[model samples]
Target: MREFSEAYLERTREGMWDDSRQALAPLALDSRERVLDVGCGTGELSRVLVAESAGEVVGCDADRELLEFAGEHVPVIAGDALRLPFPDDSFDLVVCQALLINLPDPAAALAEFARVSTDLVAAVEPDNGAVEVDSSVPTEERLESRARRAYLEGIGTDVTLGADAREAFSEAGLDVLETRRYDHERTIEPPYGEAALTIAQRKATGAGLADDRETMLEGAMDDEEYDALRSEWRAMGRDVIEQMEDRRYRRSEEIPFFVTVGRVNGPQ
Candidate 1:
């Protein structure tokens, strides 16, 4: 069970929030409906729902750091996705983003989501089936990708949550209503320039790439070397961005954002 630290959540805020809001648009939620955002990282999605639903959203997660950030926007509580804190049929809609793949038992989590919601249970997850590896990408960029893959493999969780989510929703007796794919392309800017670098650093640290922090620090190059490395890395990043923008990457499969809706069948 990997816990997201405050620093990591803050660093990835824009990307996470932006994707979540976009995913919710097609849901066509009523302004007055109550919603639950499960495994709501930093509660950004929950915040969007709260604003749109007029403060009728509640978010829950096991990470205290994320919940603390979430508290500023909506009612956030520390709880596990596998076991929700609410009673059955407590929400009109239950949504989860970027969460299913990370869970040890996604089936149980889906069952919980189904139990809590009365009208809908929607989820947005990355489709690894859509992962496009550009051969022209630089060595450092490729290194970063490899590191992420290795890290997810080490954690024994799926890197992409899309496939598993669809199956889980079905197993939980939710009707799959609408599914859409978004090939979101954006130019990541500076200050946030080295997303790949940051990812690599985190994975390295988490995986104990070296014996200890001191040893790891010693192995990592100084600012000068890192800057030089970025020159090449940026070129690769640019190539990837161009491909994504032009839809050039091979579409391995339909990477969909699963939006499901169903009426509660059993007694509350």
Candidate 2:
């Protein structure tokens, strides 16, 4: 599995669930008794689970530090997705958000989720390949794609697994019940906050993009090509910062996430 830094996780999940709940309707959380959020990083989804479900909610993660952070909101335990600490039929509902994409063998993890859950199993995952970015700077559109392609090539797990989670559920011997598409839209606009300013600064300095240079190089990009990309990336960032200073920068991204819900076969 790919380990994400606390900063990265926070950045990606900052405004998630802020605009939508339709995707969660399929879980029928009100009817659930106990809900386990697997690989619950920093309790983002766990908080939502608690809000939506009347059942007991527990957050589990392999990272003790993240678990500690998550513990502030809900009951958290140090646990792995492929090998949950609980016994069979431990919960009425088991779910994970953005967890499957990081696992090399998502099927095995799903099988484990099915093992512990008595009824429902759900996974909320994003299709990185389908990411759409609209920015004031036109170059950002192209750069994002190039960067995303290199990222997908360099990443270890199936980043595009969101669209096929239902297939994996079936393979894990769970009956596919429902699938919902939730578009997590992030808009970078007026009244920019600390995070937005920090991100813009990182881009202007190229330090953040540089962090991913090595990973991008793991694919087909050579050093020269990387240097060129960095130059352009920096330019784009400078423009972004200028726009921010001028109060003219606006950007939006729609990340398509699929919420797949299923049920355990046979009896509990």
Candidate 3:
């Protein structure tokens, strides 16, 4: 599995879950006795699970540092997704958000979830390949697409796994229950705040793009295209910074997430 930094997790999850909860209904979480959140990075979903259900919610992750960060908000345990620490039938519901996509073999992890869950298993994942960006600077759209494509390819996991979780559930010998779509739209308009400025600053310094340069090259782009893309990427970043300074830059991103729920083998 790919490791994530605290900063990356925070940035990606910012403003998430604030829009709506309709997508979470499939989990049937109201009466759950025990709920476990796998790959609960900083407890983003754990807090939601606790708020939505009155069960004993536990957040588990492989990262100790993240567990510490999450412990403040929810009960956390150090655990791996592929080999969960608890015994069989440990909880009534087992769920994860943006976890399977990072896994090389998501089906294997789902099987683990099945082992621990007696009632339901759920996965919330994003279709990174289908991400849409609308920026005031039109070139930003195309460049972002190109950069995202390469970055996704190099990630070596099913970045589009959100759309395929049903098949994975079947592969794991689980019965499919329900699926829902949730579109998270983030807009950056006038009166740009600190988050916008921080992001723009990273782009302006070329530090942001440079950080992911190696990963973006992983089987996605050849050396020639990458060199040109990097050059243009930095140039676009400078433009973004300039636009931000003038308070005229505006951008919108839509990330599509699928909530897939499945049933465990037998009664608890």
Highest-lDDT candidate? 2
TM-scores of the candidates in the order shown: 0.68, 0.96, 0.96
Q: What is the TM-score of candidate 3?
A: 0.96
Instruction: Extract clashing residue pairs from model 2.
Output: none
Give lDDT tens digits, candidate 1, residues 1-268. Answer: 5567666555544444454455566565655467888988787567667766753788899987778888898888888888899988888788887677677777677778888887677777776535544343345336445434444444556646664566766777666676655553333332234654454344333432322223222444444544444454555455555554555422111234444344445543
Candidate 3 minimal-lDDT segment of 10 residues: 203-212
Superposing all C-alpha atoms, what RMSD in Å does each candidate have to the true structure? 8.2, 1.4, 1.5
RMSD of 1: 8.2
Candidate 3 local lDDT, 148-200, one digit each (tens): 87898788789888778999999888899888999988888889878888888
Question: What lDDT would each prediction earn against the true structure?
Answer: 0.60, 0.89, 0.88
Q: Residue 259 error for model 3, in Å? A: 0.3
lDDT of 2 by residue, 31-82 (tens): 8899999999898899988999988999999999888889999998998898
Error of 2 at 238 (Å): 1.0
Scored by lDDT, model 1 comes in at: 0.60
Cα displacement (angstroms), candidate 3, residue 107, comes to 0.7
Candidate 2 ranges beyond 4 A from true positions = none
